[model samples]
Target: MVFLVCLIFCFLAPALEAQVAVRDTVLTVRPGDSLLAIAHRLLRYSTEYTAGELVDRIKRENGLQGDAIQMGQLLDVSLSYAELLDQPVIRGTNFAARGIYITAALAGSRRMLTLADALVAAGGNTVVFDVKDRYGNLGYASSVPLALEIGAGQRAPIAQPAKMLDALHRRNIHVVARLTCFYDARLARQRPDFVPFSREGPGLWSERGKSNWVDPSLPQVQEYLLAIVREVAELGVDEIQLDYVRFPTEGNLADAVFAFDPAVVPKDRIITDFVTEVERVLEPMGVLLSADIFGVAAWGREADRRTIGQHLPDLLPHLDAVSPMLYPSHFEDGFERIDRPVDYPYYFLLQGCQRLQKLATEHDVLVRPWIQSFDYRVTDFDSLYVTEQLHGAEDGGARGWLLWNPASLYEIGFAAIKGFTDSTAATVPVKLRFPKSLGMDLTRPTSVAD
Candidate 1:
């Protein structure tokens, strides 16, 4: 009988490996434990379901709402990987997502349609629109309770995000919802406890002499952020792009007091944990989760990673892709031996590509970089400059890239697109940056009105 049972199990193993993320264990929720945190501890080795999805499974199995869990509640979870082997990949064009960032205002207005048509003509396949921007405002009406509590819907700039997403979907465009994770001035002002303490006092902290950051460690903060993410995921976005996921370094550094684990843990670890939590929840939903980091990350700065709370190697395990904002202009002069890094666009991103190659291989995460679209600190910048950035990224082995124009004007970028691709019929227009969160639109145009 034993021999027969062993033979049967051996035969079933291969089949099981390809078709199941099965229930392999049961866990009891503990006091103060968020469902995602518990899943993170339990599924450290899981490849099939992210900790967030595991949390979802737990909630479904236990009939819980939101992230709430009673202490000692028994939860059943999956552990099989073979089942996920047949799971469908991200829902979009299988090709690399060559794309651009569309402001909420543009997307919410009539110009969004024009922009979408233009992008399609430019040989672009993806449109990553801002659902929740840097100011902590929602572009769409969010269903999360905390979102409602904080008047996120009231502050929404995009009148109808769902319809807008549907319109893009018809174009077969992969819609990646961008959420400015922590650099939310609105959320900070509303929940002062969430932001780090300013140097001047034991109170709220802000970056750039403004803009408060969300504390990554707080349970409420994590749940609040993830709730919005979940709502957006349900809206059928192909991916959830998380921006500003790091600890601040731009302003008042010495006096900034992190509310959660300020002295107990490293900043990079905190950022990693927060993203890991998001990955855990989003993975089960089968939605792609990406985090945007400072371009300096790819340049290989361990110190910078630690200070900013975005360590590439550490974050790889929990992310589908890591977008290092590799804009050459953001780098200092003499960066990578170039007198002005911005002028030598090809080499600036080339080094980043070569550097990220090893990390991407080691971690198996996609490296989709963000390129410069606006004229920032450059003299006589033109379409050629934009093409250099594109060629640099492609040659450097970046999977894809997104163009960023704070003012929503991509005339220079359009010119580059025209020169690089065979597509000639394109119109370069001046699009005003839309109204946004964080009090004002920092990138709004001086000549145009919203």
Candidate 2:
């Protein structure tokens, strides 16, 4: 009998351990609290289950017969892998990204390995690759169905995404995928109904004779972008940085039209709602989300914010970080009482970063400004210029900074970072602040009405 019982125990042990591995948390119901609200609040970190599905699980787990729950009742909740990781008790380092942007061409080439080595040697730990270009082409071979149907993945530069990501991850380097939204010329051309209409004529609206922008307020557009985001996140990137997230600004805006009227929905709300939807999708997968906004948007002017559909205040709630293109060269002279803004890279960067930092703090997000690298306007652009910009960003309380050079030529910029490191680099432990999401406050549970 003892031998038979011991043999049977071995089979049961595996099943018991599997059950033990399923994590659960106990929540005390407050006034007006319901099972659905709890599920929605925790849904931000759920990867597999939807809120409604999770509610069913909660009911079955807690042995509740209905959706109703009494105040102060102890309820057992199943926690997802992402939600468990997001618990305040579980902590990890949030890497301060001292980084550079890599074009898809450079990222796919053999030079990528050499560039990674050089960047790591300089104490840089982040690399933002252009996963989707401005022309609406994917940088890698994507399996997303819409991408395949639209031929978006044709001529993909980064043919072997897994191999490239593995090489970077092995070096303890954080990888950020940069995706361009809305201004997808290829996508607009393929789906003519998605393109902006011309108020002046019946044909599609074009910016400077180029019909590159799609209506951002459309549901199909948002779903398509989210699908791309999901594919990239599953590839194990550290973050997703969205660029061109606003409406077109360069050309005949007065004659341009959108699917949604600006009067009823408003432009900022359209952008904000889209970002909120993205956050809902990404947060549950444990991926960081950020947006690149115009540098002038930092001033918080209503006209500038509405025109671009990038009101920082509305967008911050859904982002882990907000990157302002704060390159001083991009600023016009006499804009901020600073003539020859390019000559004052440090001042402009500091000012713009500081302004954004204040707003970021309210939302518990980081401000990682994009610093200039190329000599677009300044004649004296050199290694020192790069170093000064770094100092200014640091002084402005920026968490980190990213260098932007379109051609991926950063020899001078790299030298500046090396010199700057020699003078001021210090080893700091990594830590990720388990921040509050836009969902219901799980930490401080309130009444259901809240």
lDDT of each: 0.70, 0.77
Stretches of candidate 2 above 4 Å error?
1-94, 424-450
Residue 110 of model 2 has an lDDT of 68
TM-scores of all candidate predictions against the true structure: 0.71, 0.74
Candidate 2, residue 370: how far the Cα is off, in Å = 0.3
What are the RMSD figures for all models against the true structure?
Answer: 16.3, 18.7
Question: Clashing pairs in model 1?
Answer: 17-82, 18-82, 19-82, 19-83, 20-82, 20-83, 51-280, 52-280, 52-281, 53-280
C-alpha displacement of 401 in model 1, angstroms? 1.1
By summed lDDT, the worst window of 10 consecutive residues in model 2 runs over: 82-91
Clashes in model 2: which pairs?
92-432, 93-430, 93-431, 94-431, 94-432
Identify the candidate with maximal lDDT.
Answer: 2
Backbone N/Cα/C clashes per model: 10, 5
